[model samples]
Target: MILIADSGSTKTDWCVVGNSGKVLSISTQGINPLVQSENEVERVLRAELMPAMTYISDITDIRFYGAGCRDEMITVLERLLRKVFPAAVNVCVYSDLLAVARALCGKNEGIACILGTGANSCLYDGEHITANTPALGYILGDEGSGAVLGKLFVNALFKGRLSDKVRTAFEAETQLTMPVIINKVYRQPMPNRFLASLSLFIGRHIDEPDLHRLVVDNFRSFLVRNIRPYCRPDLPVNAIGSMAYHYRECLEEAARAEGMRIGTVMKSPMEGLVRYHSDI
Candidate 1:
């Protein structure tokens, strides 16, 4: 059996494939090594994931791709997976960026990007990442992401950049005052998730000219700052994440404006990832 996991900060999607090609899908709360301690990760694996598996001994291979699974953090996740799946002979931990690259490009050369709660991009020559642009999280960077879009919408709303009608509607709909918003963003945990949640409101009001421009500009900035650095305009830019799938029209417009094109924009990488791993 093969077990594959795709984890974000908010959720983790798990897929188990048997030798007979039977598949079982499960969901669990996210396990990020950067934020969750070893005990927490172990608890999630044992408590949530183990319950979903019918035969743990059957899982001989485990492939985990997740946010914050880079550099030294990779070791942390690998140790936890090994502890959870002791019978597994092969356990591979990799960055979420690699998941997007493999899922979107699928052994072909292309620029792969992730635009979900956070933003990240890399140049992949089929098997490995050749270059990457640091996302720097939601505060300093993460352009074209849900968190950044929320940040921009809130800033414009409070700063009078948006019309009174929009502001009034937003305040009425969300019931969030500036003081409350500040408290959540500044003093709360997981501000990125909170900010990304506001994308729902943005999506509701996407037809608004100002809101449409805001989304387009955000994607344009991402292209200029993140994708342009790769210097490969001839190749199509592929993306995998909620933001890319939800606001594809705006993303495409931005790409066209920047003299580029979008290849594939998938809401999640699981479909392509499953295909990629199945062939192996």
Candidate 2:
């Protein structure tokens, strides 16, 4: 059996398959060795993941693709998975960007992007990444990501750039006061998540002109800063994430303006990932 995992900041999607076909599909709390300590990962596995794996013993290969999974973090996650999933004989971890490349582009070359809780991109030649522009964390960058969109919305609201009507609606919907926003942003443990939560409001109010402009501008920044540099005239661009999938119209407009075409926009990588791993 093979266990394939795709993880982001908010959650992890798991697929367990055998030689014949799929066995199970499940989700669990996301694990990022970059953020969570060794003990933290173990605790979550004990409490949440291990118990849920009914086919744990059958899993012979484990492939994990995740956000914040640098080489150091991959080593950390490998050790933890080895301890937790003792029955597994082989384990490998990869960055989530690779997952997008495989899922979106399959065995073809193109530009692959991630725009979920965070944002990232890479130029892929079917099997390997050729180039990548760093997706600096939300605070410093990650233009078209959920966290950055939320940050843009909140900043506009506070900076008096938005109209009184929009501001009033935002305050009421989010129930956020000046003090609360400050405390939530500065004192929060996962500020990126907190900021991303605000994106729901933007999505719901997408028809509003102000909010629409905000979304468009966010995608523009993504294309200009992340996608433009790696773009080739003939190569297609593809994305996988909640942000890109939900606001596809704006994303399309941005790409069109750049004289580029978007090839695929999957909300999550599970379906394509399942296909990609079937042979492996």
Candidate 3:
């Protein structure tokens, strides 16, 4: 059997594919090397993940793709996974960026982008990433991402950019007042998640012209900054994430305006990843 995972900041998708084509799947809280500790990862995998699984012995390979998975971080996750899946003969850890490339492009070359709570893009040469634009997290970058969209909405409300009717409805929907919103964003933990939660308002109120324009502008920025650097007309440009998948129409429009061809805009990489590992 083979185990594969695609982990983001908030959640992870897990798939166990047996040799006979049987499959078992589960989801667990995210395991980012930059976010959770080694002990935390082991605890979650052992308690929340392993107990739900019926098979482990036949699992000969494990592939983990995640955020913040660099050199030392790779070692940390390998150690934890080894402890949890003791019988596994092989375990590999890589950056979530690589997962996106493999998921969206497969063995063919393309430009890959991730528009989730955070945003990132790279030029893939079929087998590996040749160039990339740093995702600078939520604060400095993360253009067209849920967290940034939330930040924009809050700032607009404070700056009186949203109409009175829209502001009131938005407040009603989010149940956030000026003071609580300020305190929560500035002092609270997981502020990125908190901000990202508000992006749903844009999806719900997509009819509003101002909101529509704002979303388009964000996508345009994403393209100008991330995609165009290494982008070409021949290399298919694709994206995968909740934000990209949900706002596909807006994204397509933006891509058209930028004179870039858009390819797949899947919400997650699990299906593509399952097929990828299946052939391996």
Candidate 4:
């Protein structure tokens, strides 16, 4: 059996492939290394993964692609995974970005972008990443991400940039005043995630022209600041993430305006990973 995992900041997708290359089971959970500690990751894996592997014994291999599995953290993550799946003979851990590259480009060269709770981009040359644009977490960077969009919406509302009608509608929908919002941003932990959650509210008002403009502007900024730097101006780009998947049309329009040709947009990279490994 082969185990493949694709993990993001919010959740992870797990898939088990049998010897015949047939997927036996699929599961999901909150196991983001960026938000959860090593112990917490282990606990979730034990509860969610161990039981799922019961049908298959003598697992042969495991591959994990996760966010926050970088530098020293990779060693720590590999150790934790080894403890959980002791039956597996081989295990490989890599950054979630590699999964995106493998799943999106496979043996082909292209630019890959992840647009979700946070944003990241890389230039993949068939088998490996040749160049990357740093994703400086949700605070200073993540320009075109959910957190960034939420921050823009809130700032517009509080500063009277949004019209009275829009502001009234937003307040009515959220039932949150500017002061409460301020406290959440300044006093609470994971403020970026908190802000990103506001995208749900913005999503509700997507049909509104003003709101639509705001979304387009933010997404465009994301492409320009993060993706365009590593991607050649004429390069065709592939995207993977819930944000890019759900808003592909809008994102494509924004990218087109910037002279970028957009290709596939996928919400999950695990499916593609399964295919990539099957060929191997």
TM-score of each: 0.95, 0.91, 0.93, 0.91
Q: What is the C-alpha RMSD of each candidate to the true structure, in Å?
A: 1.5, 2.1, 1.7, 2.1
Model 3 lDDT tens row, 123-226: 98887889998878889998989898888888887898988888988878878898998898899998998888887888899889878888888888899988
- Model number with the top TM-score: 1
- Assess each prediction's global lDDT (C-alpha) against the native: 0.91, 0.87, 0.86, 0.81
lDDT of 2 by residue, 133-248 (tens): 99988989999999999899988988988889888888788788989988988997888988888889888888888999998899889988998887576877799988989999
Better of 1 and 4 by lDDT: 1
| lDDT, candidate 1, 1-280, per-residue tens | 8899999877999988776563898999997899989998999999999988987988899999998797999888888899889999999999899999999999889999999888999999988899999989888999999999999998998888998878888888999999999999999998888999989988999988989999999999999999999999999999988999999999999999999999999999987888778878
Q: How well does model 1 score by local distance difference test?
A: 0.91
Give me the displacement of residue 255 in model 4, in angstroms: 0.9
lDDT by residue for model 4 (94-190), tens: 8889899889888888898888778888999888889998878777888778888889988888887877888888778888897899899999888
Mind sharing the TM-score for model 1?
0.95
lDDT top scorer: 1
Query: Candidate 2 clash total?
Result: 0
TM-score of 4: 0.91
